[model samples]
Structures are given as C-alpha cells and as structure tokens.
Target: MKDFVSVIITAYNRQKYLGYALNSVLNQTLDKDKFEIVVITNFEFNKPNYKNIIDIYDNQEYLGEKIYKGLHESKGDIICLLDDDDMYREDKLERVTSFFKTFYPIYYHNNFVTIDDKGNEIKIIEEYLKIPPYASFNLPEFTLAIENNRKTDIRNLLKLNVNFNSSSICVRREILENNAQYLRKIKAVIDSFIFYSSLLLEGNILLDPARLTYYRIHTLQTSSGNTKNIKEYKDSFSNLFKKAVEDFYIITEMLNGKINENILEIVNEELLRYKLLYKIFSGNNILIKTKFNIHLLNYYLLSLLPTFLGNLYIKDQYNRTKKVRSFQVKSSNIF
Candidate 1:
C-alpha cells in the first residue's frame, strides 16, 4: 500500500538534533503505516527505527540538492518537510492529514512556535508572522478566484507580514513533482521559491492558525550563522533582495498577463528601499541616478547625516532587523 504522507527531514552536520526531529515523527498520533520518514543527511546519526525510514546518504553539501533528492525519492501523496533542527508537534501529522482529507489544499502551512537552543519557547510564531488575526483559515472554494488575482492577494498578504518556514509547510506531492524543475534552480531560498511558486501556480493554500511545529533558533542556524558585522548583514540583505526580485520576475514570466500591475509596483517599491539601504551601507553610488521615493530619500538623507548620528541610526535599524532575522524573540512568554 502506498504511504499517505512522506516526511522529508533533511540534515547536514546537525546530528545532535536529528534524533529529536526523527522521534517527533515516529511518535506522531498518526498511524505508523500512514506515513514514511525519509532522512537525507550527509552523515549518519542515531535515527529512529529503520522500518519506516528511508535513509539516503549523499556526500553532496548543498541543502537544496539534498531536498530535491528526497522529494524525488519520496513515495507518498502528501509531502511534509522537517528541518533537521526543528520538529513537529505530536499531533502535527494527525492535524495535517485531517485537514488534507477535508479540504485538500495544494499547500498547507500552520503557525509554529520559536524555541531557543535550550528548548524554551521564546515567542509565538504568529507574533513574528504578523498576519492579521482576522484572516480566515478556510480559503474561498473557487481556485480561479485565488489564481486570477494571486499577485494582489499575495502582496496584501505580505503587507500583513507573512512568513514561511519549511518545517511549517506541507505540500501535495503532485505540486512538488510538477514544479521540481523550477525548484531545483533555487539554492538558498528554496522555501520562498516553493511558497511563491505555489501561489503563482494557482494552488490553493490553507493557513492553519494552530501552532504545529517547533522552530529552533540558534546561533548556528543557517540564516543566523553568518552575520558578524555590518558588511555581512548588508550582503545577506542584498542577496535576499536580489533573490526576491528574481523570483518576482520568474513568477511574472510564468503567469504571463495574469499578474497584477499594482503588485509589481509594490514589489518594485520594496526592492527600491532595499536597494537604497544596500547602497547606503556599502557606500555604492549605483542608485544615485535612480528615481527616489520618500522612503529611499529619507534613507539617503540619513546616510548623509553626521557620522555619529548616521551610524547610530544605521546601527539601531540594523540591530532591529538583525534581531528579527536571527529569530531573537525578546519576549519571555512560553508556550
């Protein structure tokens, strides 16, 4: 019998947390036969029982390629991703299967809690996501309604501040299989690529409010591990901004004329802001001739301010963003 869900847990040198992640799957409320675990790791770790697990060892260091391999080898109707350092709640699989059975969305994402390395909850995921509390869980039944104006809906959703962590996202197997080629092209921002690709493909998405995954925040985490200074921070943001622009164009090209022009303008404006900041910190004059919006102009004027004030302003803004990007939850709340 075919498996109902395939949980792909990709690990790279995170052997310490792999056991916890794998055990979370094995201890799920869902039947053992209903789901299979696929472990894609570079090194062997103490995994759970081998009965329902498929361990694929690839010496290749790229995480994107490892994930692609797992997706290719997976044999299930639904695809769920688990980061090696993150874990699902015991009922995550159960809730996901139930939701899929009832509504059958192409993509499903649930709220997740952020945890520190010591396994203490720092803050609720919804707090960081900033999604409107009133956004309904069940989307409209008409796929065309979502497809015809996805760009606008997506822009509005982003404005409300949405986030997509891989462990919190699940996709129908067919969607991943269909988009595998495009997905393979992405190296670092695979999660963002999958999220936007699903939207552009007109795939219905179900955003569950329940916190179902434990996202661990640590110094070694990929996004947090690299930035030791302002230069690194600026480079990171620049790369992200460039990737967003690239993805925007790719999705636009794929959608033809179906995309909203207003959404394009919104993205362009956001990109301009990021570009201006990048120029400000990097001391680059590339954007000097570009048309300036109020936000960009403000940043420019701040960059020209007295050295102490400008540095203070830049440091304050950068530190605020770094905290968010690094998943530093300032709250003492525990879930």
Candidate 2:
C-alpha cells in the first residue's frame, strides 16, 4: 500500500464548493483507503461515517489556526492541503505520493489552474515553477538568488517565484508538527510561512510542475482581477506585499540561524511601483529604502509601472519618475 496520506481540507466560509472538492479527493486514482481526508472547519459537518472531520471553534478567524489543529488530528506521514473552494485532479494523491517516495522532499507545491466560482478555467497560474521535486539548497536558482548581493538585481535575475496555492501545498507531517506555534498565529498567510520556514530549515521543498489542482478565484478574491480598477487594485496588492514582507522578516527572526536574508524579495517592479507610490504620497524619500535603477527596466513585466506613475496626481514626483522611464517587466511573479 502507498504510504498513508492525510488530505487536510479547510472548509471555512466556502462550504458551498466543499462537495466538489471532497468529491475530487474521494475520486482520486490512488486507493481511497490509503489516505484520510481531514476536514477542518468551525461549522458542523453532518456527513455520516467520515471520522476524519474535526470542528475547530476558537481561532475561527484565521485559516492558519485551523490548519494547526488539523495537523494534530492527522495520522498521515505525508500531508496534503486543500481549500474548501479548490479541487485536485484524480491522480493528485498518487502523483504527490510518488514524488514523496522518489524525491523525499519535506515540502511540496503542485502547479494549478485558476478557476472562477462557476469552475470555468480562467488562466493557468504558473508562478516560479520548476521540475518535480526541487530541493531549495540543491536547486541552482535558489542558490544563485540567495548569493546575489544587490536586492534589485536579485529580484530581476532570480526566477524562483513562490506562487503558493493552499490547495497545492503538501508537506511531511513533521514540518507542521515542529512549527506548531508559528502556524497557529500566522492567519491566512500560513502557506507562505510554511514555504519560507521549510526553505530556512533546509527541508527538501519540491515544486512539482504538474498541474494537479484547480485554484478557485471569486469575489473578495479581487487580487486576481488587477485590470478592473487601477488605483484600488494597486493598493490591495501593496497591502498584500506589506503583509508578506513582514511575515518573511518574522519567519527569519524566529528561525534565526544562518538563514539567507534574501527574504525581502520583490516579485515584480509593479509591486515596487506601489511601494514607491506609498513613499511619494506620504512625503517620504522615494529612494530611502529602495534604489530603483536600470536593471528594473529590463523586463516586460512592469513597463506599466512608469506609465502608471506618469498618470499620477503628484506633479514633481511624476516628473521625477517620468525621467526614470523605460520600466520593462516579465509576468507578475507571485510571492
């Protein structure tokens, strides 16, 4: 039999889509008895005979806390994650288990497609993806990204994008058990914390390029729709970036060994543009924390940054940014 696996599906507010997600798990190509499905939620699950369901009452607001509780309840050595609104491919567990056997990665993230509330495929999210079973210390990109001295240069050259989907994350049981305290307090950013923490602990983190899950995108999921509103969207993303950077710093401090300080990586110049926006609007020196230079203008990802700045309300700052023209960018790198 395959090694026992636990699929921890968090059914928070999106119970409406829970059936589809559960169905996907139940219909896995792998043997059903090989894995247990642990549904973590605040509400009651009336489904009969599913012994793996656990109701978490307190710390109901943060998804991380619920996951922490789920970890304790799980009996599997190989842990898989799924959101209430997402679904896995039929062979997901089989493939993931196979990777665990072959690569022995402590952590795993599978590729996924972004879908709407109706399950219509919007776009395939391929964030900083690599081959199956890439260890952080072993991967050439990870080594180079940390070794680089300049912050902006590291941002530009390092292509290891960690676009983590909660449903796509799978890890060994010990990572969750060892970092119990960190996971409980992390709120919705739990996946990001686990990712960085695993990297810091020198755990083998596998980024499986196979699209094995469907990530749901719905309202309140406005981060996916950047084209809808100009200013509001940028603000939303800046707040996201702010949370992530702060979380990175927190992880670094908590795991304070000789961990690499490439933690404050900026995914795209667009996000940097918003960071610049905050400084310019708040009467703070724009270049105090950042030295936005020529290397940033190399990609096609953030050419829109300077153009967006050109349309700003502030005149002097706009003119200063106007001369700092030619901001190129690649695709938006998900952190």
The most accurate candidate by lDDT is: 1
Give a tens-digit lDDT track for model 1, residues 100-186: 877667777777777876667664323211112122222223222222326446655543223357787788886667666666555
Counting only residues 3 or more apart in sequence or on different chains, how many pairs clash (N, Cα, C under 3 Å) in candidate 2?
A: 6
Scanning candidate 2 in windows of ten residues, the lowest lDDT window is 129-138
Worst 10 residues of 1 by lDDT: 127-136
lDDT digits (tens) for residues 223-331 of candidate 2: 2322234454345444544444445445555565535445443322333443343443332333325455454442223233454363353343223322222122224
Most TM-score-accurate candidate:
1
**139: Cα error in model 2, Å:** 14
**Cα lDDT, all candidates:** 0.64, 0.57
How far residue 24's Cα lies from its native spot in candidate 2, in Å, is: 1.4
